[model samples]
Target: MGIDACTSRPFRGSEAVARGEVSWGRLAGPAFRPLLTDVYVGSSAEVDTATWVRAVALWGRGAGVVAGPLAARAWEAECPWEERELIMPTSRRETSDEIDVRRDRLLPDEVCFRYGVAVTSPARTAFDLARRGPLVEAVAAVDAVAFRCGLTSAHLLAVAAAHPGARGSVQVRRVVALMDPRAESLMETRLRLVFILRGVPAPVPQYEVRVRDGGLRWLDLAWPRVPAGRRKLGLEYDGPEHRTITGQNRDLLRDADLDDQEWEILHIGAVQVFDERRADQLAARVMRRLNPDP
Candidate 1:
């Protein structure tokens, strides 16, 4: 028999078989992909993070709130969807390589719903992510989520105050101090953090420079103030998208405009922000420019 026509969402294998939608053999075939033990989605189903969240919710019979990175992604944060995380109130024997199940109870206000699955609220999601990973990465994750969810430093701090004894609360507080909602991308946040961690004065995120034609040009990061004869410094994170010919041409035009306005622009790439040695070098270069020899 052909696979079930309802391939848009996940369904139980037994139910598909019993409903005469798909045979047991067909269900076991490549036509369907297993999510949990019995949970399956059609092989062609466009399974995204939300799909996985819903599948796990079904597997657990809706017993837990989806938290951590998965929850951040569900809230539109630019987080990696490597694993699905579920916070359960009680322990369970079943476990899957695809899911990270944590046993913890959540306050009523901490839980919310997204894409029809229970998830931690933005504040709680920020709280969890801001406290879990490397300091720079944690701050970047929180920045993306905060910007997407319209959260401010105060919103994150309020959550931290409520969970004073929470693991990584100190990290969360530090993240709050560094998080900038104006950050437009993950790499941008990392670039900013590199300078901050290297002891270079923190450059403003998304700094705007007024152009010749009464238009405003925003730099990825900028220091508006500088000593006499030293142009204002602007730093840009040039991701892969900026490597294309058209993108390069556009950047040239923009850079020319900024140059005419006496703004010095430095373009940074992934290596400059990710590679530790290179990151230090990049920061050192910026320091020289910002603090030229007197």
Candidate 2:
């Protein structure tokens, strides 16, 4: 297409050539980048999650419904993967290394439109993830979308119940059972999973502790019902926000107040989340603190 015709929007590579707005050779040039196979995005266009989702629709046509991370992203949920996922009914099959296609059946209601592109509903996205993803990741994904979409474990469970005999249904149920809507961050969800997987009793999320001055402090994870009476334990994931001087000073005084309240606080960072062994060790330490005699 002519530079003027590009208009900072995604268009089909064939459409550009057919309309004579641009040559086939120019279509392959740096002025445009491929968002999906045969789908090109103008270099000047803003390519974001919405653009990517809409671009896939151009290639998919009637082949499938956008599912998985793409669907989750369309629902405005934070999905970790960069690749797009589509679900084609068993009747249709398409091939692409760039896109992950799931051949499965979807109820009419499970499919809906977001940003003008057909995608899995929030409930279905969580269901698909729990059914197909690894246990921990499935839980995290479910937590993220559920939190973003204002869904609850009941919503995910209802979707799971609708798809009986589906692959990983048992595992999906287990994940839904453990998912908590109060988790506001991926790291917080992951940290909760670590504690659960290690056989430690789950801590209350966003737990509030009253300070001496009457102001309340909320903790990321807190356990007040430990085995040995009222020994309160709090766990915090120090994300980038904690790196600033203001954040540090506030945390110093907050921790001091928690200390005064006889609370044992444990802090972990992003680096600990990626190390499975270390994460488990940290959870083990917390478990020891929660149950000093056990």
Candidate 3:
């Protein structure tokens, strides 16, 4: 059979073979790729996070609720694709390198269906994600979910309160305190956490200032504390979008305009923001700018 005869959506390999949709021999061929044990998708199917989440749901016979990072992505949060996770009420011996199965009971309020896939509610997803990662990563995850789902600190706190005895409740609360829906990108959140983690006061996110032309410009992060003969400090995280010639030229103009308005803008790239040593150095530089010697 040709590849076109295979099911476009994910299907059980055994079922497909039994139904004569595709022979066992064909499934073993390159036309189909296994997502989970016995769960197969046509090789040409676009397999993104959503596809994997759906596959896991199918593998469980629709008995599991998608949770953790996968749940966060399903909610449109800016989360990096990580291991597929599922929460089941009972223990199962099935094991797969690709999926992390958590055997736990979820409260009724904690589960919801999205696009026909059962997933943890936004609050629960944020609560779960924030509980057990590096503090910076936890904050970023919560910020993304909060920003995308319009979740407030109260919503996160409520979930924390509900799960008081949960493993990472303390960390979850800490993440809630740092959560800011104003964060526009993951790197921006990580950059902000770098400073705050180093005992720097949290800078205002998406800070707005009026330029010489009477138009407003927003800084990714800013400290409006003005010292004598010194301009306010502004920080920006430059991602791949800023590497193009046009983007670089536009940044130069923007920086010049902001400079004219007594704002000292510092642009940081992935290397400076992601590398541990470099991030520490960048934070130190900002501290000096924020507190100049007499």
lDDT winner between candidates 1 and 3: 1
Better of 2 and 3 by TM-score: 3
Instruction: Please give, for residues 19-130, the per-residue lDDT of candidate 1 as tens digits.
Output: 7878888878887888787899988888888787788787777888888888888888887335678898887745777678888657788899998989999999988888
The TM-score between candidate 1 and the true structure equals 0.93
Cα lDDT tens digits for candidate 3, 63-176: 889999989989988875486888987887457686788886688999998867899999999888888678888888888998899999999888877766889888877887
Which tens-of-lDDT digit does each residue in 167-268 have in candidate 2? 889998788788887887778888888888889899898999998888899999898777756468899999888999998998999999998888988888
Task: Give the candidates in order of TM-score, highest first.
Answer: 1, 3, 2
| TM-score of model number 2 | 0.90
Model 3, TM vs. native: 0.92
Q: Using TM-score as the measure, which candidate wins?
A: 1
Best by lDDT: 1
- lDDT-best of 1 and 2: 1
Overall local distance difference test of candidate 1: 0.85
Q: Which stretches of candidate 1 lie over 4 Å from their true place?
A: 1-6, 18-20
Task: Extract clashing residue pairs from model 1.
Answer: none
Scored by lDDT, model 2 comes in at: 0.82
